[model samples]
Target chain A: MKAATPTGANIALFLAGLLFGLGLAVSGMINPAKVIGFLDLAGAWDPTLILVMGGGLALTLPAFHFILKRPAPLYGQKFHLPTLTQIDGKLIAGASLFGVGWGIAGFCPGPALAALVTLNSSVLLFVAAMLAGMALHRLLLE
Target chain B: MENFTPITGLIGGLLIGCAAVLTLWASGRIAGISGILSGLLFPHKTDTGWRALFIGGILIGAACFAWFNGGVTIEIQTSPGLTVIAGLLVGFGTRLGSGCTSGHGICGIGRLSRRSFTATATFMFVAIVTVYLTRHVLGGNL
Candidate 1:
């Protein structure tokens, strides 16, 4: 099979992103209040997020197994999978911090971006701060 | 359970899985929103167009959803101050840990990566505890 051209690859990526965002919107993950409700296990817990995750995992597990069997992607030269295997202080600390933030605002990266169409002031603020935080990490750590 | 939405949640998750699969098939890239967003922020030469288009697609997808559905409901429960702080933590932490819900929680675990499992468990546990502390202990909605 001929390798896909750059344009074709970019088109596929765009479509992928579109579908991902649509999923978030449809699943109500774009709503911070719903996300917090899921997190609040002690409160009137909402298990919708669990089912969402379960559904995602159910499909991806088998799909990834089959896809990785191929030597290369249909469009790209190779799969750019993560190679890190260590469980260290940085990973734990970073995840812990992220969890705190998520619990506080109920806005993870994907949902926040998808929700940007809302043009809500809070969403805008959160996203701007998030970008600043990423820049800060690059400056301080990397 | 008042806010539970099992059907939409499952359907939306399957769509997200399909998005990840498409990205892997076409670009050999993880559909990690944080990583994708960061790449746009600190762009590398010869690797910027697709990222931009992908993000654009997310916004467009969301807009399309609202247009079709008459408007998606998004509630931001956190105040502006807390939203900014949470955004900072999420941005920094996802970068430090190297993935968010879509990346680490879904794709990474689906690939059976041990590191992803550890990160997911750590973040999930911490997020739960944080919610418990904030909602139950603090006795006020954050």
Candidate 2:
């Protein structure tokens, strides 16, 4: 019930991100080949990624329920939840594009960020290009 | 499908869920990677600090894993040009769609958000078709 200070909140988020990255690495989710393997349903398909998703959901489901039942966060003032409930063109189109890109590169935001620690040129380039894309979207749409 | 480690995947996934839970419980924020990264690009005065910290923690955690757990492997078979293009598309699409796997798949799904469900289904279906077309129809070399 005690609200967190700004610094406390920041630290909490940092720890969360840290653990998330570590989990990504340990689970081999940072590996593009693994993701590709999962997507390769035609030949040598890997079902591990889906299992990972399953596991993540298994734990998140209960925890989220417990947290939401609380009046407020332990460190922050209020829950900043997503408000958009209606489906639309932008959501479908964007997700489709994202899925195609994910299929092509086998990288998403989380795994891509985790891969940055390797300092790989390809990873660096991907991150840079992704940031540019985000900027472009902001320029055109927002 | 060959290198599918269910236990490791589950453990790592649990860790990821724990991180998400902690972020929600402490900061009342959904640990959406694209959202976190996007907020960094389009900075608001109040939003800057935590986003940076969270990203920093991700990098630090990855570094720790690399140091302790041998290394993380990310095999990319696609050409460099294709990689950049994919990254761009991913960035643009995720932003336009408002979330990615972590947001829509994990957090949004956990929240039982109908829009997230639709988005997740769209992306999964498209990704499957894309992989099929690229690997089976297009000879698996892109």
Q: Candidate 1: list runs displaced more than 4 Å.
A: A1-5
lDDT by residue (B5-123, candidate 2, tens digit) is 77777877887888888888998899999989998998877678888988888888888889898877778787889889989989999999999999899888887889889988988
What TM-scores result for chain A when each predicted structure is judged separately against the true chain A? Answer: 0.94, 0.94
> What fraction of native interface contacts is shared by candidate 2?
0.79
Residue A108 alpha-carbon offset, candidate 2, angstroms? 0.5
Q: lDDT of all predictions, in order shown? A: 0.89, 0.87
Model 1's number of clashes is 0
lDDT of 2 by residue, A20-124 (tens): 898898888899888888888887877888877887788788889888999998976689898887899999999999999898888999999999999999999
- iRMSD values, candidates in order: 2.0, 2.0
- Candidate 1 per-residue lDDT over residues B1-142, each given as its tens digit: 8889999999989888888888888888888998889988887777788888888888888888888999989987778888899999999999999989999988999899888899899888888998889888987665
**lDDT minimum window of 10 residues, candidate 1 chain B:** B133-142
Per-residue CA lDDT of model 1 for A41-128, tens digit only, reads 9888888899878888988899899899999988878898998998889889888999999999999999999999989989999999
